[model samples]
Target: MIVRPALCTIVLTLVTVAVHAKTPVATGTGGAVATISEQASQSALAILDRGGNAIDAAVAAAATLGVTDPFSCGIGGGGFMVVYLAKEKRVITIDHRETAPASFTPSSFTANGKELDFDTTVASGLSVGVPGTVRGWHEALQRYGTMSFAQVLAPAIRVAGDGFTVNDNFTRMVTENTAKFSRFPATAALYLEDGKAIPAGTLLRNPDMAKAYRALATGGVRAFYEGPLAQAIVDAVNRPATKAGSAVMGGAMTLADLANYEARLRPAVRTTYRGYELYGMPLPGSGGVAVGEALNILEGFELGKLPRAQAEHLYLEASRLAFADRNAYLADPEYVEAPVAGLLSKDYAAKRRALIDGRKAPTASVAAGDPYAFQRDASVPLRPLPAKGKLLREGAHTTHLTVADKEGNIVAYTFTIESWGGSGIVVPGYGFLLNNELTDFDFTGPHPNVPEAGKRPRSSMAPTIALRDGKPAFTVGSPGGATIITTVLQTIVNHVDFGMPMDDAIAAPRLSQRNGATTDVEPGFAGTAQAHALARYGHRWSSAPEEIGAANAIVFNPDGTVTAVSERRRHGIGSALVQNKAH
Candidate 1:
């Protein structure tokens, strides 16, 4: 069913039933699902209503998002998923992050030992990686979901077949990325109309995507990873559209690469913050370690009593310290020895915390701290690699979702295609984009994150779930590449310390420090008295009026109900299941 005739102009505003200062405007009594698109959230809730568990609902929502919000995510991309299964009283962390091709090397994009053109590399097929989203979803459904893969993909198939109305943001993105989209014939044929990009409000349908989903549903994951779909991916990625006679424009990905991809369930990076237990992904991706380390540093401060400026300053310092390690030590653990425990230890954070001078502006100079300095083995073989090149900034291009069921099952999922439009290469017969994930690796550096054959590229996709007293407290995550860590961090702090409601905490003004002296904050956040106070402490704000990351969350209320909240700063949606009194 078309939940709303057109989602672009129709903002999803749930009725506010605020009974307490801590109550959110978007609340429900049984379960809740939040995503950047309302249509997807509605699909997830419908799945819950259809007897699906939290994992099932999450799979439904995520699959639907591939149709409704393809700019940020799709079956072509890969990401991380964290599931809390109440029955087992444990967490399941899945790393479906993309990997470098079998032919990858640190100098894959270098010329004469010098780095290739960044923009050229990003737009070419050289940036493609083996996608894991399909296999990941299949594994999630088989292991945790009650519904079959066919049932979970039903909604997305319907949306792609019946068509959904485009929103303003979708229109704008197409306009901004017109050059790239036009470069690839497949991308141009799929996204354009009459030699021009389609405008918002048009009903867009993708029969090709629907066909792929149908094959996936019937043929199972094999149809995607080992069958014809994999062939299409390999063909599109290898045949780049370079100048008629220029060097080849594609990567060396093979069908074998896609067939070999696995969404492994690894241990969740665990830590405690303000009496709550927090969980995140471990390296290969450093989100969990970084979040854990920053929280450990924050546990020592009384954020509720500090002024906004001091609070910002403290957060800035902690983030700088965490990212210093992130830039240096966090990478594919298969290739580097990340000091996970040492980096997240409270004792280590205290040592790094003491380095912050309240009177001066901090620099990345003290970053990549000696986590091993506080470890049992001071001579740990894993040494920090020097992060070089201009610091990488992942653009605000990703999607996140949080789902909770009445059965106590909860999921936090984040996925991406690297940047907007995602390599602009749609498979010939499939209406989906291929990922530019290989660009995430440094082309010619010896950094821990440098590209290596068959190794997964490190990610900032931190999907986190928090528990208080061993029960679900809140689930949160966002879509701002490097800004994701700080965006999610601030939300947890707001709800845990300042007592802000779920919606407020998610929509609050935010700041992000990615190993730098200047922090970029939400517009108007730095103009306040608190921002000036931070200026006094050398917290120079970025002059560019760029928005930081925006997050979506689901908080479990004390009354046993749950509330879903989306980023009001974004064009998204949230909802909770409530009993219909009329019914």
Candidate 2:
């Protein structure tokens, strides 16, 4: 909440604007919004048009997303928000990441000394964490927003009551999770048509969610964390509303957990990338540290001057090196002695960079680098790295949105319910899915990310804001589980180093290397000459998901105008809108 003295007060503001088409790019002067869903983007634009600040639009859009993109994010889940305050000329972060309940322990995911099946765990109440999205929204509004909670939440309440047209992406996700959703009667009733997937173009409405929003708007944050809603959440988690004959693992979440849940205000992780200052969410999100470390490693090379394939090769290697450290050390800073300062150190990056061979990739797993020696604080002890790093299976489903108001206030937010249809158990009357976020923790450890009482699990949701010469240049973020780091890092590289336009940077194919033996690449990238060239460098490749990340960004142009960009192909092609067209 510290505000530095303002250096630049002139910021692009928003005016009444209209979006004619659901396009992937929008350029204007006043304000801009980009998100995976057209409904969410429009909600944000509407807020900005009404003279709301970026924080207001962001919350409005997030609430709308809960209605339109229910499987991805909602009040049932939690997320990270990175915000740039125009008046203060400062970047701040909100960590509303879900926390393990007091009942959780290191062995919570185990049964009879062995780890439980991952998929089985994901579908059970045991996977649900105390949701933080509601409180996070409250914190944002209280601290920064100029609009009231009732005002920002109005659009989402309308969307919930009026309904929205389900698109192909929505249908596909439902179809993929049919079995999981069928286990719970409430979930089945909402998303399925007599135990079958709901078809595309279907108009879906959740009056219960609308009612829930109305309760929040009337009673404020207290209604959610103290009264009937809190009791319902605890009941759902502890007693699980499942059909008879279905065996579901119930959680131990209590009303106290809900009452005590708080969204923390954390410092934004800052790093310099090619002269631009990048600010992103810090722990308990691993994205900021991991992306910053990778970019720092890549900074030693003149990536723009190198062959495209060569530069990509370096990018992949840097990602691998960065992930190794991230997996070994990064976690909830309150619980783990994370070497954050060392991890972001240029010296540490240079040391890790030396491992990259220009001609070829490493033949074996790249081990985690020792960052303790580079730690600025001499009192911190060195932590031992595990002999074998276990790759926790995090869901590759989430949503991201970027918003900017006329006053130059910008917000980049990434939120999730942990998995598509999350835990597959909706609170019988609440009309939202609880997060399967506990599954994000390591099943067994000796690891920093092992489940613990009241600890937030490490997340890959990276919401970033970039500043150039003391003013905002852009804000960017993406949703793709662990690949989130690579998506964000590569997108920044594409725009800043490769000289791609913001739209092109988001549209370009992606590659993700998480210290694995093989790098996962999108089909578009695999079919290119650069892929072939990289193969010559001993880089092994595998097919990535249909898409790597659904990214959204807003770039501030030099002429006081702004450009909003979204994916043109991935996730049904996101929507980008501007408040007013530049003349």
Candidate 3:
């Protein structure tokens, strides 16, 4: 492996620190622990101390995420988790991805037989998908946790009822995205008051959400999907205020959709690269396949021995190959031929890697080899949409949590409300944010991602775990919409290939190959010289701040200590419990 003596030594030194901000934390070599939002992390750690396992800790953290990080993720949204079982040496994938409502159709967002503007289609009820967060958490807990539902959810209830001080990040996001919040009354009521965004340290409370969590704790997953909460959701969606105006399409979510929503347990897509086995979420998400494809292509090149420029070339080229395939053939496998296996194959990546020239970056439309040429005929055509400037949703706020217990069990989970505070649509009695995830799909028709009855929308959330010799080695994930996969991939490279410590790996300057050739260099690295160096390769650098993605990770040391790292770009922090006696 390519290693810098001083850099590697520094990484090792940081990993040895008993405590550091934004780094992962652990206690006993094999004791239970959890990492998530600062508020939720404490709660999850409490669960672990109370005899809970990784699964129990995850549930606790997920519930707290619904409360504290509601702007980005909550029970109203859907997500996935990758769970590693120590005893079985098996990695299981939980697909709680949001599905299209029963009333949703290909033309749901069209008016006068033409596609509506992205804002109109994305914000209204018509944009909501069947939420899966509640069901998904319940499934993971029931199958793997030692604690009961009430125990896991109690912390979230307490947080919502007692309230917590709004952090700086929350305040800044609310101020910046106030316009979108003002458009919806319920949303504005929760986040904004008197026409001004709530300042930091403001005591934010949602007793209604507390009540809903109480019901969930008492009634289990069914309580939310089939019980009183479900009825409230129906009522909220049917309310006149919830309907889309004359300028946009509206929706009514049937009770049947909620009742029938089932979170599936599938096999994680695992691929071997340079002796390490990488595990990531499968189809409904293009993340795993895309990450694998990019890594595979880079594997053909001797990046471990290359200088910075050559390494950048390989990174950029591989990213191009992966992104091209993602746009072309990746989708929900149930609805289309995704070519999951073929796309990640070594042979295919080798051929695609051969197209890269070490000297220059190619244009955006440059074609990469079709790795799945054999099944090209079976691939479903992606629905077409009008050429609009890049559209990003408000409340891009989301959180990621990573945990690895002493038993070798690892959990990488991501949850989101799919916009800041999720359309600001909180059911009067429900007390939680409702997801705008349906906006993730193209509202226009003739695309593979077009809304359809019971179809799951394509998601960019990729919660992942990595294993070495059948044991938990790394657990990590991020909250950057389409940038999730690229961020996770870069972190893994920083940890495994470059041997960077958890903190530096997460904090290092990073770039994403997801949307065109976006180079998100950190502030100091974007100097005139670096800009000129990038320009030589035809790279047009945008002045966008490198707040690309927020990531959290934990590395399991063979000696029993756990190293955790949280992203510095946003207000994320990482902590661990080390065994002082042992050290």
Candidate 4:
């Protein structure tokens, strides 16, 4: 077995408070925020309290996450944001996924006539991609926000300077990445104390990160992509700050790559499920297409009328089918011709759904289904299927935040740096980790997701906003690599088909089956009656139990109030707060 570095390790710190207790659910009338950290949720709630719209509050919370939950996400990474515009009566999306540098090639991860070991590339600068988080945030604020970059970034800046109390999560992440972090002087200086992980409850200050935020506040996006900050980033990637004799591989990133970076406003992926319109991120992120396909497959069944176990069996089967197509066809649209319209077509879903046996799981592995016949543009020929590519490993990390304002505007955003400490190389003086996102590409070629110059790697971030009868229904998202699709899909199913409250839906146990031979079931679901009933249907579970995803959601009630729900068990419980609620 290949033993890899702990890529999913993440730290969760509390802002100003010495002790923290996460409130996983909150309900109020005006506005609400839910995230993995208390400080981030509070930061967003404060913005809403100050009369800022959901877009403004989302930016504030995301920025604050950089300070309190550094290992999960920050300005060093990129993400996708789905926003609901109450006045415009439309949903829009921002695609800020990191792109490979101009120097990259299809064979970039290859070495000595073969693909390099996955772990070897993980912590090296060779895995770094051009970051887009800052640009994405700037675009969101400039186009849809009521506040300036400085205004939204104030909370993060203050938290970074004031210092936060480290918790067990913080110490655990440091301990897991000690070997990698120790190799870099800059990374070690902050996370490690004399080559050891800092103990829990210790007050950790990051003046350097505060300085970084201040620079962006004054210099704008240009400061991050062109000025001294850009230079520092390029230097860090090209010549990583490694200790002598460590022999870490540096990247080929250049100033031109950084300067050329820009976040885009892409059309959201739209589909209807049970009369509700679902909107999600477009290409370069597979969440929407995959989730939509699975939902389409499930729509044929009356899950509400079926036995709970039977409904769950179908859900798992649908996930397996959707993932087969996702892995086979989805990639950066600029590099590949993915038949997205066909993939999400109801006709195609009916055809795929026919393969599921209600009484049993597929005894053999499922193959990708053909969707070209349902393509809107029938003239486009089907591309020849290549041999299956190596599964690009993704750590179950990253972060998701949801916010809604009194205006009815809502934002569901998910962002990441791709691993615990990213490439585990901290930029000298910048106090942020560069993303190892390029590793998301399939290492070998002759495939859709192969590495190429300026190509954006496909992501599983499904930030979703659903609407019923032209009004907001709910907005949901999660952070868990490939399982993100299943998590979001299941949560929606739990609430819509099974008639659970939003909080109960999120708190429910999860099962992730991504075309694998055995489904990965959470411990909470492993020994239950549902598991046994499913087992009779030939459904096998992974030997080891795994928590699937940390998902957050907001439910819009018929009464016009919003209920924000966070994970009650995952990521040490999450924080959910509302603008008018005193709790």
Candidate 5:
């Protein structure tokens, strides 16, 4: 391991403080802890209290979130679920990510040898993908849950039919996407009122969505992807837009794509960090591998003993290195043969570590490194070409939830519609939106992550769980566009390496370095002592407000309790469910 004495010592100091940090202690006697939205969480806990497993609770909350936070997630989008089955004592990942339409082609986003305007592609129907959320929920429930689909989906069904009171997050997102919503009259009519964004506390109901949920509960996954609902989705996907919208040729979505969509059970990537084993999602999504790579590099330093600012300097360096590889090498494993093993290998991390100079920060963008040295017979690493232009940020428009039941089973899920309001097109009578997941593809490029039929787009949503001493210890995740990997990485380091309590870790100030000279940090960061600490190391910095992520987390206590934290940065709720003795 590459050791620096000063680093280890400072990290030890941080560890001492972390032990005393004031995050509440929760007990399994409370039944379950759901850290995101209470309405959704309470529903999940009720399932567990009624003798359902973690998977059932997760399915319940995930469905409820679609009703409560429509802009960020719903049946219209897709997501990943990482589960630790208590009975099986093993972790597994579900790949419910959206895929490109079968009709999509390489030149779809190009005209006359130039890329089309990204905004145009996003605003048009061409950006919609084959959604996989329903398939994932059905799979999870069938494989691990003990509750009926109707039981798990009941809460969301009621909320959609009865209406939910809008919160700050709901109002804020609607205001921000007014322009996109206005462009599509169907979407404009749902959330916008009197030609203006809906205000907070408005009670909104979607009876159409309730009927859609009823169909799924009655007919299972096939109801959404195989028949009337399926035809409705197709019609919505291929709907005509106004003249201003593109009549793009490759925009037509096929019934086969939707009918054939499958939620595969993929291998969950694993890595050892500070004696704890961290588990995260694998290929088609970059969250797990990138965070693992960054963690491996930082593993060499004694994070808790170092001054916060100095430790942050090391974090920035590690993140920069990992992101370089993420941007260059990561792609759909099925389509692009990503070298997953080599990217997470300790030896490769050591080689990548050599590029970090303690005396200076990286000036220019760091390029991808050759990890093939560690892989045997693996596909050659995809060399990163110069970026055609800066890609637009996907927007912090996703939702994440975690559930730890009394049975010790744990579930971490992250889902998204890709951007604020997604394609801004509702499925007419269904009253739910469709994801602009195609926007996640390279608009026009020869990169490894270019658009391809049936390929899952590279995602930054990191739904993560960790085990210590061979038992589930903590779970955390976030929604921050490209900053997600770093956001999740920092939380793990904050709790595991620096000793912060789970609540404090989730709420801590954050910094992100995406292979650039400037590191972005949240406003009022406490690590100001080392704010300029990396200036001598050649790193420049800037302070921004809530530009990183909103991470929700749960830390399992040795005493059989847990600590839950809903990110205060947004409209989040963290509650430990106490089963009524009467129940």
Candidate 6:
């Protein structure tokens, strides 16, 4: 494997060693505040202290997240943001999801009617979706933020230009995933040097990315999509090596695709469970419908009265049904048919709920309540399947941030490059990683997720905002791909159903059901019998590290103070700042 020196190795090591040696001191609180990554939270709190609104704080935090958490998110990737504008009493969903190239088609990765290996299909240029993070942020600022894009992006540019101390989590991720970076020359040159990975506590800078951002600040989103940056991306994709093999590495993502990409605003999917109204991303994102269906299905059971094991069974059953429907019917509504109403309907949920046996696990392909006319097309033509295991096929490592201002405005944003540092391909002179999100699409033809021109790839991004008694009460989201919906669903349950505090709710152990696999309980789970019982149902149990998905949340208490918490498992540190409160 090729190893390269990270620009920040030494500084990162020293800083990490020093920080670990000392106890962390609690900081920040009351009227107006922000919390995210340790440093990003501080930056947002500063913005709040300066009289900036929630939008301002969120923008600041997001920009900071791009710098300190580069592996998960950056301007090069795309995402979704749910904004609650208190003044207008409007909750808008920004559908900034990545889109497919105009030349993309269902057979893009197929070889003689067979599906290619998942990794081989989605990791290269063929899998890249149209990026929208920049456009989403820009539109958000233009609509509700008090500060300009330049002002909000200042912190990120400063961090990238002046350099920042790398943290332990980032250092470890870089070291472990170094092989991915070596595949692309530009990526290797930017992230590594002299054949060694950057170590912990290194001081790293990204002048090129900063310069690109500087131009963006001056010229808006167009500067990146229509200017020299766009040309660089096109050139890089078409480089000889990018097309040297039969693999679909380089194709037609021309300057036009970049220039034409736009971030659209849509209505948030709204559903009521118990007494609270839940809102999440819709259509292109199955997270909202899937989570809503799970919640609706579990509502049929008395989770509050059941034993912990029983509750786990109920959760697993609901997850199975939701996921089955997801694979069968969910896709970009702009390109395919999705059973949104039928999937989320209470009647369908109840029928699916009845399939759970409680005493034992169902077989791998147990039937869930099907939506109207949902056919099991066993005769569908087979496409070449990629030769990768589920573990390797799973995409993750993204950043989530929740922000709320005194006026009741809120923003929940989730961003990513669609894998650890994306495909490890960095565009020369851009200094940011490009998303490998195209892998999210099925390379096999006849699958609902097959790629198509102008199609938006399905995403699990569920940036959400909820209103209670007609006002913003909670803002939450996570960054775990397929697990994202599960994490957010459980968090909401812990807070709304169990009445846990925001911190405790987010801190709760999370379990995920991915592609028929049930991940065992994470840290802080109080039950093992449930895990053991799950094994009896033909379910394979595996332990996931604490670094799964980091969930961040902020809740508006009845008294008006905001409680913000970040997941500790991912080494997440959150801050609470109150406006006009004595320090």
lDDT of 2: 0.88
TM-score of 4: 0.95
Q: Per-residue CA lDDT of candidate 4, range 162-248, in tens?
A: 767778887888898999898888887778866888778766777778889999999889889998999999998988878888988
What value of lDDT does candidate 4 attain over all alpha carbons? 0.88
Error of 1 at 451 (Å): 0.5
Model with the higher lDDT, candidate 1 or 3:
1
**Model 1 Cα lDDT, one tens digit per residue, 1-583:** 1222221111222222321111123665666777877668777878888989888988888888888788789999899999999999999888888888899878898988788887777777888889989888888888998998889889888888877777667777788778777777666666665446676667777777888899988998999988788888898889865323445377888988988888888989899998999988777767888888998998888988987667767888888888888888778887877778788888999988887776677643454677876656655765554464246746468888888887889899998887888887777677888888888886767677888888888888888999999899888988778888888887888888788887888877787877775888877877787678778987777788566655788878787767777766554333333322112
Model 4 segments beyond 4 Å from truth? 1-18, 386-390
Error of 2 at 551 (Å): 0.1
Candidate 2, superposed: residue stretches over 4 Å from native: 1-21, 543-545
**Candidate 3, residues 194-282: lDDT per residue as tens digits?**
65677665667766778888998888889989967887776655551432443333567989999999998989988877778889889
Q: Cα miss at 416, model 4 (Å)?
A: 0.5
Q: Candidate 2 on 387-492: residue-level lDDT in tens?
A: 3654668998999999999999999999999888778878767788888999999888888899999999999999999999999998899999998999999999
**Two-way TM-score contest, 3 vs 6, winner:** 3
For candidate 2, list the clashing residue pairs, or say none. Answer: 12-406, 13-30, 13-406, 14-406
Error of 4 at 420 (Å): 1.7
The TM-score obtained by model 2 is 0.95
Estimate TM-scores for all models: 0.92, 0.95, 0.89, 0.95, 0.90, 0.88
Better of 1 and 6 by TM-score: 1
Per-prediction tally of clashes: 1, 4, 23, 0, 17, 40
Measured with C-alpha atoms, the lDDT of residue 225 in candidate 6 is: 86
Minimum summed lDDT over a 10-residue window in model 2 is located at 1-10
TM-score of 1: 0.92
Better of 1 and 4 by TM-score: 4
User: Where in model 6 is the C-alpha error above 4 Å?
Assistant: 1-36, 121-123, 240-248, 373-392, 515-517, 520-530, 533-539, 543-546, 572-583
